[model samples]
Target: MGREFIAYIPGQKDINGQFTKANLGRTLGLLKKLLKGGLYEFGTLTAAYNGWAKGSPEYDQWMAEVAVYPTTAQNVIRDAVVNALTHVKGSNDDPIPLTIVWEGGPEGVTSRYEAAGPSWTVTITGYPPPAKSMLAERRDKKPS
Candidate 1:
């Protein structure tokens, strides 16, 4: 079975404030590869793009809540997303930072992930539903 989900990419533009079409394309492409590479399954996956024109929303509703499978699938997807986004190059051959925000799951897991040149940060939270579902959120990290 598959699940629906959403993913957000922060700072949609290059350092110069110009739209980075290649960066966006590469990031989404990497995610697609993960989906096709047997990492997990997704239904209702959508990317809320921030266009270069005026009145473009700045980073909040970058994505929406959707579904995802395996419950633990996020960790795998995060690892790949961070790796791929960090490596994405601009027209000037510079690396770009990617901050991905995702929400949705059986228990509603929400995550905000970011990775820059040599550093990365990932935070994921799963909720306990008022009503039980077939899947439970996975929390493997110890409290800091």
Candidate 2:
């Protein structure tokens, strides 16, 4: 099976207290570009919420599953994914908090990009093995 990751963008509100569509559009556009390489496919966008307590601002957080070809190198995929998500900026050109959970599992590496840092911080776990090409798999399976 191919590898997949979950990308998350925390809901952001503008000065008028409305969820900013521009931010969402910009992020989606970047992701679309990343998919142009033919190695990635973006899943449907899902609405997620946070801070459900009383008087807490509730907004629409967007989550999407990005699937990558199993033959691609892990580091290459990670860099491309992180680069695309981290480039998304708010209306005021501020960094937006974004996250990607590699392999779409609890045990996968969870990389987070916060406004407080200039790079993605892996707060979860270690990296998975580099994917092997179909040809390589077949070659290895051949009688030695």
Candidate 3:
């Protein structure tokens, strides 16, 4: 026998089927919401993830754990950045202005000239692969 060709795995599917841009977009939007609500901390997300509902133990716990509000923090940082950016000069002696803003949430508007602080910007792309079973199910389903 030369090379062996294996059959499909039980719970693995191609990358197109599992995670999707829509899913990622929604997740990112949720993160932004959490951020604007002063819920940037990982613990806050964890609490929200665990479950967040009114009059429930999980919600209460999340509230307790989430101490900071993202809006306020972002505001303060933006103010400082704006003022500083206006003053920052390039090597040529020209002033180096800047701008930074969050894309969604109540703070939806962009702040003119620099962000509150140095931020780690990222562009997340693509979706995760689906499980084989899920793939099969999708394939089996009739077009609708």
lDDT of 2 by residue, 59-120 (tens): 21111112332323334434544353445355533323333333433334444545555544
lDDT of 1 by residue, 1-144 (tens): 122111222221222121133454554554454464544333212232223222233222332222323446555544544454445445533334443333344443333434433433332335321111112222223354
Taking all chains together, each candidate's TM-score versus the true structure is 0.23, 0.23, 0.23
C-alpha RMSD values across all candidates: 15.9, 16.4, 17.0
lDDT of 1 at 131: 19
> Which sections of candidate 3 miss by over 4 Å?
1-26, 29-47, 68-144
lDDT of 3 by residue, 22-90 (tens): 333333444445664433544333334334445555445434423333555444443433233223335
What local lDDT score does residue 96 receive in model 2, on the 0 to 100 scale?
A: 35
* Residue 48 alpha-carbon offset, candidate 1, angstroms: 4.7
Task: List clashing residue pairs in candidate 1.
Answer: 3-67, 4-66, 4-67, 5-66, 5-67
Question: Candidate 3, TM-score vs. the true structure?
Answer: 0.23
